[model samples]
Target chain A: MPVRLFLALLAMFVTGEAAGQVRAIEVLGPRPFGYFIGDVIRLQVDVVLDEPFTLQAGSLPRPRPVTYWLDLKTVAVDDRGINGGLHRYRLALDYQIFYAPLEPRELAIPGFSVTATDGAHRVEANVPAWSFLMSPLREIMPRGTGDPVYLRNDTGPMILPVRRWLSLAIASGIASVLLLGLLAYNRAWWPFSTRRKRPFVQAVRAARRAFRSGSGAEAYRAGLLCLHRAFDATAGRAVLADDLSSFLKTAPAFRPLEPEIGRFFQASRRAFFGADARGAEADLPRTVLIDLGARLAEAERGLS
Target chain B: MVDLSSLFHHSGNRWAGVPLLSVERLKSILLVNTLVVAFAAFTVSGWLAFSAWNDNRVISGLATGRDIAVGDRARPEILLARGQFLMRRGRLDEAQALVPAVRISGDRRVLAAIQYDLANARLRTALRLIEDMKIDQAIPLINLAKDGYRAALSVRPDLWDARYNLDVAMRLVRDFPEIQPSSEEPPQETPEKLWTDLPGLPKGLP
Candidate 1:
């Protein structure tokens, strides 16, 4: 009685396990031969489900590279349209075999799980693993060749391509340095560096200091002397009223100051040697004379 | 093209030489200079950050292999590294197990994996020969490994590493057997291969 009960129980367990796999899964080749590195292979899968289950989205394995060499390139699933329970999935794989095998050898392709969706309960089925031969490029033992194939050696770590970035960084670094130099050269802001002072700039500063606090008439004389000294130093010759034309020829940088030079010469003639000193003050106001000196200094600084 | 020739004619270009605006505008220089510096920093720093991220991925991959997460999809880069590690430690079985996947993604890196496997394989044979006190038995194995390195070099000349290992191999089996090449008989065993990790054969054959 015990033996009969055990046999009955074993049969029931086996039947239950078989019944749970409501769908059938059949996996075809990774293609039998003539494969090498960087080649693509095709595999066909057939899944037949029972009456209650229907194939739908997410029912198949997600398309991804099964292994580094074997990539799942494309996945196309077809439903028989009439719902005859024959579901077909065609998988395309791109592979590259680095092994230069001396003889024809087999390589395995790992299989994955497929899920079939019902109203609430999901039935799962396993797609058995499959393999195929990878044919060698050359003979296992070449007859006469002195150079024969040997084992592949280890590889080094990957070195990042930093050439592009390094070049850009170097270029930008140079540009910034040049720009900084231009800024420093233009501005006399850093006083330690020696720079030639324009003659007109020096004269303008001297004139401003000459009239600080004194008799208006004496200050007037001092300012006139200051203007005469600037013109003589700039021309490298005494610049009398008659020599104004020659002065303009020698230093075209002061061409804009032609009118101002004429005025200063007239004021000089009246202030030092004229019978009436009052006329000198009226001809060139103290304020106008100082402003003329300032304008000339600005033009000098603008000189390239 | 404002016919700048006319401007040059004005008063021998002395007054005109002075740009209408004096004082180099420091604002523009500073702005442009700042922009250059920023761009430089962005490129260099970006690469550094990327390198760090790559290193992290490799670290995570090592952990994944150590855990022996069989079905877990380790990145190809990580798998290559782990395979190399196993080979170096003389765990040829574990190393060869990853060969199919590594070999499939063939490139120069594959040459590297091949190089590692060959060196380790030679080391295994050399150690075995030493244990048996048979120095002569190791010569062909070393020569075969050198030939493998040479074949790898022929595939890629840019591998200085392959060149170095080839040199190492050449030094190991210092002189070739002068008498063997003329003979018609091919060695019964093929040379060491980069792919399968076959067990070493018993000694006593030429």
Candidate 2:
């Protein structure tokens, strides 16, 4: 293809030199058939000049999006060594066509002008325009007229499964929190500050600890005082051993522990008022106090 | 996209003036919501599974049913239908990817149809193009379709449709010649000697 172009240029150059000028431009590719949108075409421009003239390097075309749907992608100028005193300039131009035509049609690749200088002797020459075939993307033939190939139908998105999962997760989280909260409320934990262990329950815990530590007489005395305080608090009055029957009537919760209550009072009398007070061995030993407190605590459960 | 902290902390405290957001009622409300949401999830998953089954039904139906042209592919059956269309159009990679996804109410017929369509699509197209394309290019599609039809028939021997298509495909494609195995090679006897080797026939009948 280049040899044919060179021969064609040679003929043009002979005529051009005889006319005191030489400029030949040829678009080499983009065959005349099956041309689609987004196809790039290549063109070559050869210029030969008579003596005292040189092709201007700075005058070549700059690449740009040239038209509505066409772009000049690249531009290159090569120096094909001078032959027979005719300066030769080869401009390789690349153009991309993005035109979509329903029917096959011709689209021109606009031409540009180049400059030649001979030390203050300058002349501008123009390359004539060229054209190539342009065709549409879709096939031109029809399959059937009754059920025409319609444009792409609209597609509806299915409900994403993640939304269902997310909702379920949220609900599960809330339910978990609710279950924990209910448990806390019922079990007398935090945020249910009003719910507290009864004083007798506290007394039971203290006595049980005293028994475990084997803190003999002092621990036993401490357990008695706490039991008295719990009895007084439950009866809403100071409860003495003499007022035991009245305390039981007022706080019937202690009725089930009446025997243990009487025992605790008798032991308290022996441990505190009797001469055996401050003895190394307590009449109401820590073990007995622990059992008495435990019975009272069991009765306390029925009260509430 | 749902901010759970905000749902817990936000002004969704009351519904219809019942103070539903208060801690007092929040527990019950949240518990109920949890149950409802779990039910919703189950329902949604079930609904989606049902649609998938329906999608398979439509896909298998597209093999021989109407309104299944290339352009009408944006339906519930689009997932498999698109693959089938692409396969018919000779786009194999995309079609193969959709083969494992067919399920019509967990029916095997749908699976058979899926396989049948995948193979028969190319077979039918190749037959159409036989007049236009060289024999070398058309034979591969014929063989592929033949194999697919055979596979479907193997699973459901009663599938007359698959049987018919198999017959058509067999005419276009031939299986490799079956060679019988033998311990010893046959005797390399000449045509004249074969008569002498025969026990019942006279050696010089002529």
Candidate 3:
């Protein structure tokens, strides 16, 4: 099949399977998803299990019908499925919760497991966890309405020139120093240099230049080279051909860039080695590299 | 060439338009607003999450059941129900066996109540065995009855029947009066002569 057609079909199939799975449990919840004290927020866990299950009450340290607090009721499960399979089961559990007192609390709808025999094997698949909120009953209500808001300052323009120039100047100065150091350290790093010089910014700038020049292959290579040098600098060690996984580990910030990094690496291998990695050509793009850089910058900011 | 000065003047006029909004000022305002909204949202969400948590807590006095089958979780309701069904069917021994393994505190009181009934049944059994002269078996069963009554009393202290049964057992165990030598009476002289004659007493005893 043609490459584009194949990808489209694969995507369709994955999504199709994802849609059919039933949501067996729901946190019907403290409706409005919020609660106040002295309010009974009715909650029901709608469970559609393959086997008959019981909705028996569990023990609590404090009993309900408490004199000064609202009561939490006990509901028990029926044993309709003492001996049944996942397919032969049809059960839904419903519960109501009351937030009588002003105490704020968290509650877990415990994991439920169903036992099934897939013809030749018996397996248990636990439904994922479910939980809900209990806000403290607010002590005070809102007072009188407030006035309309307005911006009062006219010095907005003054702050911009100082803030923007300072940040940009600092960034440029840092990039320049790093570029000069890399150039002086490794003259033999690459045979060709196209006025692209910073370790991180150079890679991004080179790719941008290549895209502007309408050379996709050059743009792609520049993206990879940028990543390679950044990886080396960040790792403080030589990144080997086979140490990409280790490189990601050495710099965990790049973990979010996995998809982009993997794509670039695949494109580089196929372009240089003359090997055909199916779908590489269709997947590689300049925008992806740019986005990867943006993500990296954001991650770096977070780290700082 | 003909319109150069006019074009330059128009460009200068355009550049002179009211200064564009400062990106820094807009960003700061946005950041502050976002932080305020997020903090409020986080507060509300945390409150909602806690409310949901409260709903899931198991409260006491509610009838709850669990299953512990071999290694299977003994479902309290199933086990308790089975015990009740068995008791109704007159399978007292089987029913009694089911009650002890139920561990859910929510079901403990109910289980204790059932245990009280089981104790009563066992007491009846022990009484029957004693009537039949099955002394060896009756003793063990009577001891079991006492234990069941104790368990019932522990859970339901207000249960008078369990207290009465315990009282019955205490009363049934006969207490012999402590015997002492008579304080006022004189010693018998003839008994000493008899003791000497019988050759057990010393010769000077009389």
Candidate 4:
């Protein structure tokens, strides 16, 4: 019974060894010397396993303080899939060493083991420890006159550069003002209102003023004279009753007002030459004359 | 002459028929549209300029170390400046409260700087406490400062000042593994053995 048990145990060990095995473990790192306190050291470990064995990710190291003076800042694993009938994985570990040594001294990063499994069998891949030299930030005996514990100055808040935004605002503001000016010019708003040659508009204003001050024949005669003056100014010459058609032909925009303009000329002739202001007012009332003047002004704006 | 007669005919037809939108009517429409656009542009640009000027003024005041009351919707730069101002005045809690707002700014550089400054302030206070022999009170503050420094380093790995300060804090208090109830074996090296094995203690002042 004892001989049979020994043979069974040997068979079990042989099968276990054959099922899973770590093929290779290789570590790549930076130059291991001349590091200062608080410097991060990174290591790349590549592990190759047997064909059926795969890395168990849970066995990887967690980010934590590995020692009092060293912190495992980060850990990452890259699966290389399968190549050459072997399962491969690359492990990246970042460690921040906080040791402030008085002189250049060597320190060792502790080794750890990761597990690989193939269903029923398990194997361990050992990553060897790494060592590096760390140097002190300052001298043991300082030459400074002040305190020996030298701390770095705080990085102050930066003053945001406002020049770009300010310039943009200024440029847009100028564009807006210029656009306003253009709109004002187009609308004949005051400033531009007086600058534009709106003869009929001025005529309507003068005729209204005359009607406001006077009454009866005098007001009617005055309104007729203002309308005649506006027509002459618009035509750039004296415009008689006979010249109405030619004036309308030259300014086609005013062709829509042909009948009303003809009535105005007939009224003008009666008021000034015929010396019958009441009769002229009867032909075209003061309100009608003023309304015609306003419409002519609007038409004149369209011509320009 | 042909063009003029056709124009006259068109105008006559317009007056006699539907009285279609005249040239004057079209001009009036154009004028109204332009006026609306100009007015809108003027209002918007004026508002932008005014707000930019106001922000600059607030920033200048902050630079001079004045405690200006800022609204909740203040920009990230203003919040960062206020946090720094608070830190300088030893109002650490108020400074720390501004972290979420500053973080939301998405300006990584500013966030890292703020974290580093807050950590520095904490470490300085903790050192003062240690000098006064308040060991228990200083321990928590040092731990907080270490976390702040670590956070800053995570965002910006090249921040040497934060790294140095973190190292200083680390030497003040050592980290030991937490005991797990499931593990039957004791830790490989006890805290006492690890502390004594190397000159881990801070010599003189940190």
Candidate 5:
């Protein structure tokens, strides 16, 4: 009868404990010893609860100076969701210890309670106090030293990396100048003004000016000579009437103008060599000669 | 009796029997496009070079211990330099004012350096006050210095100097819980009890 009563009481106690919503609380951290001044200690706390209950975020500890010698640097919480009918919450806490102990001393991080609620029911879970041993950073006493307390030197201001920007600027400036030079070359600007590539253009201008001067034989001869000069320049040498075929073969770009060129050469021979200037004028009018000059200029520039 | 006009017109499209844009017009179009690009490049290059030059000047001025005029829109590095200069000149308040500006800087190193320097300045001042037996006046400065060191260490944990200084400050004055006034007790004995509760000089120090 006495054994039966004892067993029944123990079962009641176990059932009462299990009836609470919070299931378990576990705290994990680094080794509890060998910490010195300015060392950070990280602790992780995990709380398990029934599926319906959720941890109250507001009840969690806010980062602050926990003690005079210890600073609670950061606190982070992660909800692991529900697994196997248990809801889990993980809390990460970072604390920096600032105690300069003369000898190894034990310190306690105070415990706090957190609440979990499922709208209608509220349950409390306790995080137990943690203790750690802090070691001294330096000797308790110095023996015959000139300087008893020596602090570390301060960090100086650092110079920004300006050389990289300077180099980039220099490279871009060089590229811009080179491009500008290219533009100048294409536009035939200063130092390239005399290197005009369009000789037929100059011939057209000269022939127009001579035709405007008068309709006399002298003016016609001048215009014809201008055209002859243009041909010589284009061929890079004196191109006589007989060299027409070779010039056409070497410069296929002017092959379309072969018939007109041949007519001009015939008219030139009649006037200068055959001494029939009037008949040559009839064969090739001034307007025709001028128009032919313009066409040659256009073809030379690849415009035709 | 060849019709010259017809012949010339035929020749216009007879070059390889395909009409194409004139070479001069193509060359001119290409030249204009290239010129615009080059101009843009030149403008960008000039701007970069000028800014770099200006920044270098400011850096050199700071290195030589010259007081540079800081603008509201000054760069982080410039603000840091100014803060360091003020701290070195014993203007702790002005240097402290620059903290919020430097705190927002993207460069963690610069932020840490400024905090460390400012903390050092405060600690040095507090030490002098302690030498003069003005312990009451020095407590706040030491506390502020400790806070500064902590902030610097948060950003750059490898800052050994800041850590060492913070430890030194801690030993000078240990932190304790703030006393909350109890309505049941008389306020007269509070000051005396607080003074007694304060820790005395550290142990093992002459």
Candidate 6:
């Protein structure tokens, strides 16, 4: 029995939502916008809400005593009850006034009231007076005026409305940069290393700096070996045993620095493996090792 | 297997109006075509009889003019040749003007045939005007073209070329830019609002 009652209440709510009836009315725009003498000006009134009510002017607060120059008429009324619930119906009323042939800046439209009813109960609602300007007509202007002027009470904006949406503009720019950065990182660098990983250039630079510090000669040699291993990972071949000539021939973008690679390898071989000690050149000193590393770094840039 | 039974069930509920549709649309088209073909055959026979009658009428007139009796086919052949030459040169108007003179005077049927020919020439002239985009000038010319085709149809209802030309002329005239009366008032939103409001009204008889 309770479920049945609930279902009946739901059905009633649905039916009530589908029915559109006028209740309160509001004047949306400026009380006074603009008007010319002898010309008819149309003022707009928008119905705020409409449901379980109907409006009649006879039950208003001031019953027909006031007289105004402006003529009011219902222009359009829409009673649509789909999707929007009780707020679907909208009533548009027009207030028209003919020019008084006077150049006065201000004119008043009288207020009126309406009766609201929901069959059993009755209520009276009042609408306030609206004002309008009676201004002189402007002289004929050239085809292209420099810019259009906007009045304080005008519906249109003084400047483009989109100019105030700066946050949206900044957000769009940041999104674009993020999208491009993602594409570039994926295309150029992300596949090779993560944060914990070291790049081939960084490893090579570390070896060169260690050699310059004079104490870590063995560490510098190990660094060079590690860098060579990283380079091999990119080339898909071992580079420690391979001749520089053969490597340069395969990767021709590095062909211009073939002589530098040859010199560095020759000096390293004489210092570490050769039987005849060419004294100063024979001993792998820190300064000589640093210079050789710098030369190798330059060669790597050319290959890249 | 499921699809086969579904298809059979679907076939059972097929539209019942198919028979009426075929007979009303297809049969009418066939009937019209048969009637047009019969009329064309009749017009061909009429044309042959008219040509022979016209020859006899001219020979009789010539016998009266010369005051001597002679059966000569050379003169008629020479006139037909001249008319064909003028028509081939696009001088349809000049050629049509000569057809009446050769038809022999006081022959009512021949005079009607000549009128039909003149009408055809006027229709051709109107078509040329339309091709030039002279719409204002083409309006009168198109009417004359329709009149000429109508006259030919009155005498020879099976002339397909005349019918086709008349149809084309009518279409071209209708395609011309139409002048509309301008409203004095500026564009207002009230009428559109009224139209939009109409859709929300109750749909039943009330």
By lDDT rank, best first, the candidates go: 4, 5, 2, 1, 3, 6
Q: Write the per-residue lDDT of candidate 4 for residues A183-257, one digit (tens) a residue.
A: 678777866875557788889988999999888898888887887888888789999978778888888989998
Model 5, runs deviating above 4 Å:
A1-19, A142-149, A170-304, B1-53, B183-206
Q: Where's the lowest-lDDT run of ten residues in candidate 6 chain A?
A: A149-158
Comparison by lDDT, 1 against 2, better one: 2
**Model 4 chain B, TM?**
0.63
Model 6 per-residue lDDT tens digits across residues A1-304: 9999999999876764554244346765444656643233344554434466655445433312123233443345555553443434344555444323223567676665555667776655555666766753332221234222111110110111233234444444455555545444443546423322223556566666654555443644554454556546545687643466677676675566566556555555554465323432435444554555555455555554
Error of 2 at A233 (Å): 3.2
lDDT by residue (B1-206, candidate 5, tens digit) is: 76799888878758867757878689878867776776676576667667756876786687679988786467677877788778878988997888787776577887888888888888788777865767777778988998888888877877878877777776666555545666555323232332342232332334
Give a tens-digit lDDT track for model 4, residues B73-159.
677777878888899889999989988887887877878888999989998887777657676677778779888887787767788
- Model 6 ranges off by over 4 Å: A1-110, A116-120, A126-222, A230-236, A241-290, A300-304, B1-206
Candidate 2 docking category? incorrect
Worst 10 residues of 2 chain A by lDDT: A148-157
Q: Which stretches of candidate 2 lie over 4 Å from their true place?
A: A1-146, A156-197, A213-216, A273-282, B1-206
Error of 5 at A204 (Å): 32
Q: How many Å off is the CA of A11 in candidate 5?
A: 9.0
User: For residues A59-166, could you state the per-residue lDDT of candidate 2 as single tens digits?
Assistant: 878887677456687889888777776667778887765454547888788777778888876777778788777765544333444422212111111222345544
lDDT of 6 by residue, B2-62 (tens): 5798788777668554555555356556545554554454455445555555554544443
In terms of DockQ, which candidate is strongest?
A: 5
Better model by TM-score: candidate 3 vs candidate 6? 6
| Candidate closest to the true structure, highest TM-score | 5
Q: Candidate 1 lDDT, tens digit per residue, A106-145?
A: 8776777677765776787676777777764443333443
Quick one: RMSD of model 4?
Answer: 15.2
What is the DockQ for all candidates, taken in turn?
0.06, 0.02, 0.01, 0.16, 0.25, 0.01
In candidate 3, residue A303 scores what lDDT?
Answer: 34
DockQ category of candidate 3: incorrect
State the displacement of the C-alpha of residue A274, model 6, in Å, after optimal TM-score superposition: 16
Candidate 4 docks with a DockQ of 0.16
Query: Which window of 10 residues has the lowest lDDT sum in candidate 4 chain A?
Result: A140-149
